[model samples]
Target: MNAEPTTPTTRATDEHLLSIDALAAWIGVSPHTVRKWVTRGPATGLVPRMLRINGQIRFRPDDVRVWLDTKEIQ
Candidate 1:
């Protein structure tokens, strides 16, 4: 009997990962701006919800949503 090759599995929760470009588009900013925001020190007042995996930066959709809510003016 031949066995099927197994493919690497990713958790369903990983679907929330957003690339820098995607996050920038969602927040109406350039990708370079997002990169700078994430890379700056905490004193710069940038959101702290970021993930760096395999040298690629990603953001969580839920975290971004929460950050936006916290930044509301009203």
Candidate 2:
């Protein structure tokens, strides 16, 4: 009999990549908001930077941190 692995083989560092839902939760917003931000793209100048790999939107931890830092009140 053959068995399938339940867990993925991704590296721990790869976990820092944020999906729309994960980013939304981390940023205290809904997934729809994340999608909207992505849809708006850089035109609005209000969205965090993201990486597009194979057309998938993925937010890097560093980019998210920088964006948040820029938006924070001094």
Worst 10 residues of 1 by lDDT: 41-50
lDDT (Cα, tens digit) per residue for candidate 1, span 25-74: 98898988888887784346675478889999887888788888888898
Error of 1 at 40 (Å): 0.5
Taking the tens digit of each residue's C-alpha lDDT, what string does model 2 give over 1-74? 65976776874565467888888998898999889888988557566788888888888887788888988887
Clashing pairs in 2: none
In model 1, which runs have C-alpha deviations exceeding 4 angstroms?
Answer: 1-14, 41-43
How does candidate 2 fare on TM-score? Answer: 0.71
Residue 70 C-alpha lDDT in model 1: 80
Q: Of the candidates shown, which would achieve the greatest lDDT relative to the real structure?
A: 2
